[model samples]
Target: MSVRRTVTVSITPEQDALLCAFLASGRYRSISEVMRSALRLLERDEAATLTAMRRPVAHDEASRG
Candidate 1:
């Protein structure tokens, strides 16, 4: 089991409309579900970005060895 916390966030009208669209599509059950999916994507993207940033350094060191 995990603990859950509620946080209030402000979104622009455009963002609100997008969220409503997702809800209408029935792909997500709630705003929380949509937010969780978005967060997961963000985390994956950040990790990929970090790996990309380190790739050039790794290649340079390999060539010098």
Candidate 2:
């Protein structure tokens, strides 16, 4: 089963208008879809950051024995 979540946040006037225009154009069915896309990108970027943090250097550096 997919977990459903809700978030409440704020945006600037220009940001709000831009999102409203996107919804009005029917490009996105709902505000949730727009937020989901933004969050998904955040998740991917976060994962990349975590992986890089864990592996600071490659094995080539370890081979200098």
Candidate 2 lDDT score at position 41:
100
Model 1 / residue 12 / CA error / Å: 0.4
Candidate 2 Cα errors over 4 Å, as ranges: 1-6, 24-26, 58-65
Q: How does each model score on lDDT? A: 0.95, 0.88
Worst 10 residues of 1 by lDDT: 52-61
For each candidate in turn, the TM-score is 0.84, 0.63
Question: What tens-digit string does per-residue lDDT give for candidate 2 at 1-64?
Answer: 7999777899999999988988999889999988888789999999999999888576767887
Off by over 4 Å in 1: 57-65
At residue 47, what lDDT does model 2 achieve?
Answer: 100
What is candidate 1's lDDT per residue for 1-65, written digit by digit as tens?
A: 68999999999999999999999999999999999999999999999999988777876789999
